[model samples]
Target: MGAVTSSMAAKFAFFPPTPPSYTLEEDEETGKLAMSGVPRRENVDVVRIKTKRATDVVAVYIKNPSASLSVLYSHGNAADLAQLYELFSQLSIHLGVNVMGEAPMLPYIVVRQVK
Candidate 1:
């Protein structure tokens, strides 16, 4: 039974032996790492949110944020901020709303209960 279940789980699992794409490296000058391979835009603000867990959540905010609406983007596991930077920027401009995109991570669901 265990063997059969293990085989079934492996057949349906989405784990990859290696990273799907994108490589992260530290900058030689600043020794800071950022998502590369995408065009970096100016005038974007970096906002960090501190969680109760003591982890800092980082996001990028486009210039001239809208007063009415905003978007909090959580990218898929196989993607990163570098890849979606342009799309988010365009969305902010086209939708006329501020966009906050969080970096992608291991696949998991985020459920926030309303008060």
Candidate 2:
């Protein structure tokens, strides 16, 4: 397989679960945003959740995926949550999954990796 190519301005890049969709960019300095001209429209149900595992804390944006939920996580100390948000969204699209996220909100979902 070949390496993936992305065109986003965020620290990280994420694609939707579906093929030929939009990208999400997370700017450690400037929150997050969905890249324009994606194949699918932005769904209101998409959610972003901040989580911490063991001594590592990160953020994951969960999209509208039915089979397996796609997750976009940032490097532990690479950048702040702001930068990760956008990239997380884009990552999901790249992986062919919907996205769910929260921008500075409560009622978050915490997930633990069991492996």
Model number with the top TM-score:
1
Candidate 1, overall lDDT?
Answer: 0.56
> What is the TM-score of candidate 2?
0.30
Give the runs in model 1 whose Cα sits over 4 Å from its true position.
Answer: 1-35, 65-67, 75-79, 104-115
Q: Global lDDT of each model?
A: 0.56, 0.39
* lDDT score, candidate 1, position 43: 49
Count of clashing residue pairs in every prediction: 0, 35
For model 2, residues 11-109, the per-residue Cα lDDT tens digits are 254321222222344444445433324333444232344456323233334465552755534343233344445565566667767544333322231
After the best TM-score superposition of candidate 2, give how far the Cα of residue 107 lies from its true spot, in angstroms: 21
Q: List the residue pairs that clash in candidate 1.
A: none
Model 1 TM-score, all chains together = 0.50
